[model samples]
Target chain A: MQNAEKKCAVKKCAMEKSSVTEKVFMSLTGLFLCLFLVVHLGGNLLLFKQDGGAAFNAYSHFMETSWIIRVIEIFLLLFFLTHIFMAIKLTIKNKQARPVSYAVNKASENSSWFSRNMEITGGVIFIFLCVHLYNFMFSQRFFHHYPSMYAAVRTVFQNPWYVLFYVICLSWVGFHLIHGVQSSFQSLGLRHPIFTPWIKKLGVLFAALIFLGFLSLPVYFFFSRTSRRNVQSAISHQLKIENGFKRGASQ
Target chain B: MKFTLKVWRQKNAQEQGSFVTYEVFGISEDMSFLEMLDVLNEDLTLKGEEPVAFAHDCREGICGTCGLFINGRAHGPLTGTTTCQLHIRHFKDGETITIEPWRAKAFPVIKDLVVDRSAFDRILQAGGFVSVNVGSAPEANGILVPKKNADEAFDTAACIGCGACVAACKNASAILFVSAKVSHLSLLPQGKPERRTRVLNMVKTMDEEGFGNCTNTGACEVECPKGITLASIARLRREYCKAKIKG
Candidate 1:
């Protein structure tokens, strides 16, 4: 009996450790992803150089070939997966915590809509990530579908549907970051009277910068002359393929 | 004045609950929220209907006994004030006020507005204390404490364990309450001896009580009657991390 009691105590302690440890992992990985976003936005800014994708393509090439970046890419993938897994797990537990909800919850009175709807924002961002990775990362790394990374991005942005989706997703990213950034610091136990308020303001600023910085690329490319030319050429290219197939079938 | 009260009525934990509406009249703006309820109950008693079962004691708001989710806001539409202290002036005449008990898995409804808050007591029993020898009272100034630490500790210690934080949170998390206890004790020299074990054990018990994790929404801080801040939660995390690392 005493041995069983001791075993129970050990299990309880382990459970306690994991609960806190899970939050720590969530915070650390989230902060790392935030850092990755800064670097990504910095590199993508090369698209605005007006050199018709030369600077951006060169930057992409370097990003693809660098061994350090390759290593960081693996860690980044791991962190992203861990973050999603922990988020889902914690969300499930949180839902279960409140089996009975209030009949009339004026939640807006106390918390922001974005703060309360993190799961919705996060889920939207995750969906966007899958589409984004397929469009750019996977295509560039393995498929080599276009002449250059910038060409691929420009082609994708030429589609009004894709551009609209991209803009919406980036806005969700902003929403996620607005809450996630400072919340990460709090989870990591870094709070100060003077600095915390500053951190909160900085979090909002960082989110806005990321939102606008990434937003400018898609909006710019969608309306740019190059993208329109690319779209017309793509349409003609499709016509040529169809016409050739028709002649071959007729023969 | 007249008002319509939509109050949550639950017979017991085993029963399903729903909102019951009652029309209350002759309510003055000067009457406290609980006093308004008292008038309603008096009317209900005179009418031979069962009076609304709500918890209240030490109506001065110190005992943390009275709690109501009034009109969707915890402890009514006031900031840093308990339900007992909230007056009818905040509401307009003929307005419909919604009142419900704190909702959480760990805090099941015992009756109408009373929840079983023994879960808090259990968590407190886990480690919300310091050990001292059973003898004559020790000198208060024997241990030196920084003024800032004392003030912070006092601020956090103001948490009355009313479960308002839990009610206000979207996830019904108890982190604010637990962190308040953890921060209040851990900040003082008297609470230093078993600081590590205290945090670990209290957190363990807290999780076992089925409370949710803190998502840092700041709702609890805003809804807290005692005005406990989220900084205590940060301090709790700091102490928790330090304890775990040291172990």
Candidate 2:
């Protein structure tokens, strides 16, 4: 089967090609988005306490108003888009490659389970982001204009079906974040012998904390009461003011 | 430690392959993985059975010839190590091990353990190198590169042309392998002369060779015996972009 398939002199030069730079791009984009997730989780946790919706809304509003954050957010969005697009392209290309592996294929047994599941996890999270934007961003930014942001917030999550949808999104986001955080380091060349163990543990700790914070919101909303005190408590607890604001903010 | 080996045996490239089971007694833990296989091969020869065919060279682990798929992982259970260098101590007595070869579309089995890695050579021919002038070699100090960039490029250069990345990948992508080669030359002055043509030609070659695209699943880096990063692939994208823009 040794047909004479020859490439050009320079083209066949194996001395120069390796994937270092592309790994860096993948790492930077993936890590930056993880930072975005942390900030997002911080705001999402506020949804758990009383006045949570209004509080979360105010936090969202604050993020929108900052020029620096606005710029960063745009970049963050771009990072998400680029990462997804690259992932799709790369995956497709790999799929079209050779079929049967060599008898002595090494390295396939030693990889981690999480790293292997990136495609499944990434796809899940991508779907979650789209649904999240539809429920919170699209409705609030584009739909019926209510004078109070709190009213819009309460109206969305108060519905049992919507609350359930948000819950599912939060869980999948958590799954994606766990694998994403560590894989980013692998891409960036951070897998040094001594630090690898510590870094992996650190990633797990961080992912768990962030996931719990984000997951609390939908859980809190499910058990909400319509009492005026409920609304007041939500707003006061979420905004972090002591009692007596008494503004009706029910779950 | 002695262990039970379940190795795939194929009569030829076109013939059907099957797992041939054997038990090796009193194996030394310190012996390299290949040494243990050697002992077993000796046993097979005396028994009048065909000795197992496995690929290995530079038992020091750098030539990229050893391609054992052990226990479902590439290069056995060790992280960042080739089979020839992997110690037998990683296995326990009576443990059953499964051995196979590099599996991919472009790589076909030539014998028992060896596959046609010439696809990589083919890919390289497609434009993996920089075409510099045939004049006298440049003086050692002619090109001054930042120490950091040099170090970084060297890290990518560590890839041993082993097809582990291809085997570990679910999609049989050679992105990590190709990226390592691409990034090494792209970073240095010696590689600059043909940078534009290099990217364009190599990418076209990669597509033509039937290697799959990178999905960023990151299995390649995890399974690499050299710990080659996926970042090299990112640099490939940038190079591709620059090439596209220039064209």
Candidate 3:
């Protein structure tokens, strides 16, 4: 009996460590992903330059070729995967914790709707991310569907359906971040009486900025006549140059 | 005043429960929520029906014994008040109040409007006490505790183990209760000796009791009758990290 009790104690300690550790890791990875969003939004701002895609294309080229970026990309992928995995795992346990549902839950009376429905918002963002990566990242690196990143953006956003989808997804991202940023800090135990309220407000402000910043790009490309004309002419000019080079090589 | 009450009824833990509507009349607006229930029970008993088996001890709010998930909010619509302290004036004359026991896997319903909250006692047994004995009472100024720590500890120690936080949480997480216990004890000198082991063991037992992990929704904080802040949870995390590192 003594030996069995000792083994049970060991098992309990390990289980306790992992459960809390899982949450700590979730916080760390979530904060890292938030940082990635800041950097990504900053880089994408280059698309707004009036130079007809030259600066944006150059930025994309450097991003594609840099070794440092490659390493960061690997970490980014890992963070995304781990955050998603932990979310699903935690959500399942949360559901089981309340086997019987409340007959009349006025949850909104106590907490914000976004705070309660993080899984729904997160799942929506994940679905958007899959489509988004396929549209830009995969197409540029693997498919070579467009000559330049800006060209791909121009073509894709021209379709009203894609623009609508992008706008809706960006809104979901805003909802996710509104709760996510401050919640991450709380999970990591970085809270203060005065600073916590400020952190929550700042989180909402940051989420709004991200939404508007990302929203401007697709909206600009879709509606601005100048950008539309410029992209069309730029694509044709690039095609002509490529054909000329092909004929010269044949001779 | 007359009102409709939809109360949950169950014979035993194994039996499934359902809402039983009871029309209660002549209920005064000044009566406490539990007193109103008592009136309903008095009527039920006179009619040779099984009286609603609700739990209560001290009519005062401090005991934390009287809990009911009334009208979707824990302990009724009022904030920072237990059911025993909640007067019926808050409700409309013809209001249909829905009262149910705290719902969680760890807190199984024993009967109508009562759950086995011994999970809380078991968690407390894990490490909620200081085992060391200092035999005699010391001088008043012996420990020299800081005012802020003492106040915060006192605030956290006010937790009544009501399990209202659990009922209010969407995930039915008991982290608020556990964290409150941890914060109060860890803040004092007597509790410092077993801090590391206490946090680990209590958290283990909490998880074993099948409570959900906190999702930082702030629901538990909002619904806690003691007004325990989320900072206690943050402190718990900080303490857990320190313990793990030191270990």
After superposition, candidate 1 runs with Cα above 4 Å error: A1-18, A226-251
Worst 10 residues of 1 chain B by lDDT: B238-247
Q: Cα RMSD to native, each candidate?
A: 6.4, 9.1, 6.9
Question: What tens-digit string does per-residue lDDT give for candidate 1 at B1-247?
Answer: 9999999988998999899999999999999999999999999999998888999999998989999999889999999999999999999999999999999999999999989999999999999989788999888889899999999999999999999999999988898999999999999999987787788888888889998888889999999999999999888888888877666
Question: Candidate 3, clashing residue pairs?
Answer: none
Model 1, A154-196: lDDT tens digits are 8899889999999999999999999989999999889998999
TM-score for each predicted model, relative to the true structure: 0.92, 0.67, 0.92
Q: Rate residue A15 of model 1 by lDDT.
A: 53
Candidate 2 regions exceeding 4 Å error are A1-114, A126-165, A178-216, A226-251, B130-155, B215-219
| Docking class of predicted structure 1 | medium
Query: Which has the greatest DockQ?
Result: 1
Model 2, residue B181: what's the lDDT? 82
Q: Give candidate 3 misplaced runs (Cα > 4 Å).
A: A1-18, A225-251
- What is the RMSD of candidate 3? 6.9
Model 1: residue A215 alpha-carbon error in angstroms: 0.8
Question: Per-residue alpha-carbon lDDT of model 2 for A122-226, expressed as tens digits?
Answer: 787788788777766666667836544556656666777877776776666666666677666765545565776677788787777776776666555556545
